[model samples]
Target: MSSFRLTLERRQQVSTLRSTTTYILGLLLGLGFGLLVLLSAGAPAATLLDDLVIQVFFSAMGLAQTLTLAVPLILVGLAATSAMRLRFWNVGIEGQLWLGAIGATLVALSDFGSESLRLPTMLLASAIAGAAWIAVPLILKLRAGVNELVVTLLLSNVAYLLLQHLLFGAWKDPVNSFPVSPRFDENEQLASLGFGNLHSGIYVALGITLLMTILVQKSRTGFYVDVIGRNRTTALATGIPVTATITLMILLSGALAGLAGGLIVIGVEHRLTQTIGINTTFSGIVIAFIARFNPLAVLPTAIVLAGIYNAGGTLKVFYGIPDAIVVLIQGMVLLTLLMVQFFSSYRVSLLRQSAQQPGQPST
Candidate 1:
């Protein structure tokens, strides 16, 4: 008689082609599973698939809306990537985003700059605010040896409360008596690009993506990030300015998240509201992980996510599918991808146990 045991082993090397194929397979499997789930729930599978494909990709209006959503998604994804490179867990991206929005709102409401300069001023202020918001957690982590994850997560609640206070008290729109800031001035708002809900902010998002790609792929900072991520102790011993690099990357992460908030206000919402950047933290983390934390991959990943969000909305509006089901489907897709990613890096093997065990028992 022979007995076998299952063993898990990490792959020594995974080719790019193989890795990509596995991820693609994972996506197909996830989508297929989602289809089955919807069908089981009595959804109109035939028309639903067609509508999802047409509306998310083929239709001009759908593509426009997707691009609009992708702008901030791209920004937030970059934010996560920035922190991830340094092995920093920036769980407060939502809080940083709110701070960014607040910064932009202050500029818009106070008329801080001339009409011609208002938009630029708001953009600058938003980035600064985001950086400032993250600085607290970064300091605590670096100086006080605190856990940034907990601090950042807690700060998100604080940021939300602050946003609520401002909206309900100081910034409420007097005309509508709503818990929202005054609409941005024409000059302060991101201008339309002659498309459905698409705005000039897409250009900014694209440009930033390009810059980040360059930084991540070609710069010393990128090299430092990789080294630090692999081994922080080795990075410090090898004369890499680990502390400075960590600080820079974390701050960059916060700034990018903040910029997304500012962009949402001027580019999408055109005003600050309590609902601004809702679910952004999860979306950012999802996009970052799906893209494998590659800056160049963030754009396409963001578009795909934006399409899912758009499709989810369509399902709710057309089919009356509950939000919970949509969330579950999203979770399934993410979970599938994660499982596939894990398998790509590892393999399980069955090994036969040696017969010597019987001789040893006899002895």
Candidate 2:
């Protein structure tokens, strides 16, 4: 019994370590492939690698840019993590983000004179809007027994159409002749850090990450969510409010996704546009998957992804590499990580002598 318990504990420890180790291996493989591509392009692979390392680790400005890019990624990653934890697939984070941006745009356009109320109102509206956008799919799943995956994906396209409609019709800047919403009020803009283009959104993202970590690790609601995720029928049998738990989890995920959209507008874009939501939903999925759906792990994963993004611009300018190279690297990294997960979670072993003999008798 003692040895059996020790073996169990050791297995658990190995499983936990497997996730971190696999992620590191995946990143290394991605870097290796990137270098191969650089060599094939006739770029100085050594110089490019050195520059990337220096920019990612040694340059203060580079670090700031990375964090700035990571702010939205962190928020959206958390959103994905939340829904995944509840076994709820809220894949419409892209649409939720757009709705959040729309909400923020509405607030920015309104005549809210009080400077104090401006930021808070925008943030609140974004959260509400995000939740409302997700509620559509949630209701469809709960009430009509729809497959959330299809509903969420379709909604993302719908969001794109909505954005285009607003830009070309109602919210078009008549003077500028551009398909973009009106610029945000100056007061509505997120405060910038002294560093390179970093904004208050970084702080907000960090705060949310910490808060979510605590909520998931320490709260009763979090416990119930975990239980429901692992075994919904068991949770219902135990008198846990499984439906309410699912609803809250979906709403929380949507709110986080919305916060990411709000950050994009208030901190980066300062206006809504047709292209604002592009690729963000997919990026969030990558971040969440890379982190293995752990909210706390999402932080470092977001930073790494952000570094990749920043490096892409530098590569484009210096090495004449296309911007698509960065996307390709991200795809490779995700694929490798998934493969590692498969190996870690399963094992194949040879059959015992007696079993093998019986199975091979006919042969």
Candidate 3:
């Protein structure tokens, strides 16, 4: 009996260790792929790795840019994380982001010229617009039982087209002769955080992350969301308001995504452009997945992704490699991490040998 108990304990220990090993393996695999990319580019792999290490850790300017890029990614990733936690797949974060920017642009152009009120007003309007955009697919899913994945993706394309039309047709700035919206007023823009180009968006993103962490870990609403996501049928049977819970989660996610877009306009780009939405939405999805849909984890993950983006610029200037190389590395890393998650959750074990001595106890 003691031997049997020891065997059982050993199995449990192995299982725990397996989970830890899986994530370490995933990180190493991602690094290997990055190294392979550098080798293929004809750069010394060790040197390239050293350079990236320096840029990410040692250079103050590089660190600032990393935080700057992480700002929007944090919001976008949180949006994805929130929807995902409630078992809602909101693939239209990109469209919602565009809607937010468009909404903010409208506010900037309107007659509300008070310096004190402009930023807050635009943020509010953008949040509403983003939630409204997401509501289309949410209603379709809840009312008609439509698959949200298709609806959300299709709406993203529609949103992009709408942005194009506005930029080229009505919102285009006549003085600049560019296919972009007018620059936001000084009062409406987000202020810089310090002497660097980093904006207040970094603080907003961090603040949102903190708030979400608290909500997910402490709030009653979060408890309901967790329950609904883990087992919707069970939750419904237990008197939980599954539909309302899902809707609220999706709405909150959309609002956060809108805030991300608003930050891009008011903080980084300072104007709405058609190119902003091209790949940023997709990047958000990647960041969210890479972080395992954890709201708190999104910060470090976003910062790492931003480092790659910043490093890609350096790679381009110093070497002849294309920027797409960085994207490829990101894709590989995400794929590997997903595989690691899968393996950690499941295992294959060989059947133990029967202990029957000879043919005595075959039964």
**Predicted structure with the largest lDDT when compared to the true one:** 1
lDDT by residue (17-85, candidate 3, tens digit) is 776688778877986887787779866666686557688656888888878887888888899899888
Ranking of all predicted structures according to TM-score, beginning with the best and ending with the worst:
1, 3, 2
In candidate 1, which residue ranges exceed 4 Å CA deviation?
354-363
C-alpha lDDT of candidate 3 relative to the true structure: 0.82
Q: How far out, in Å, is residue 72 in model 2? A: 0.6
Count of residue pairs whose backbone atoms collide, per candidate: 0, 0, 0
For residue 341, model 2's alpha carbon misses the true position, in angstroms, by 1.5
Candidate 3 displacement at residue 33 in angstroms: 1.5
Better of 1 and 2 by TM-score: 1
lDDT of 1 by residue, 1-363 (tens): 678999999999999997999898887888789888877766796888666778887899999988888999999999999998777899899999999999999999999979999998999899999999999999999999999999999999999999999998889999876788988888899999998999998999999999999888899988999999999999999999999999998998999999999999998899998888878888888788778899989999899888878877788788777656656666677788899988999999999975565447653
Shift in Å, residue 80, candidate 3:
0.8
> Which stretches of candidate 3 lie above 4 Å from their native place?
1-16, 350-363
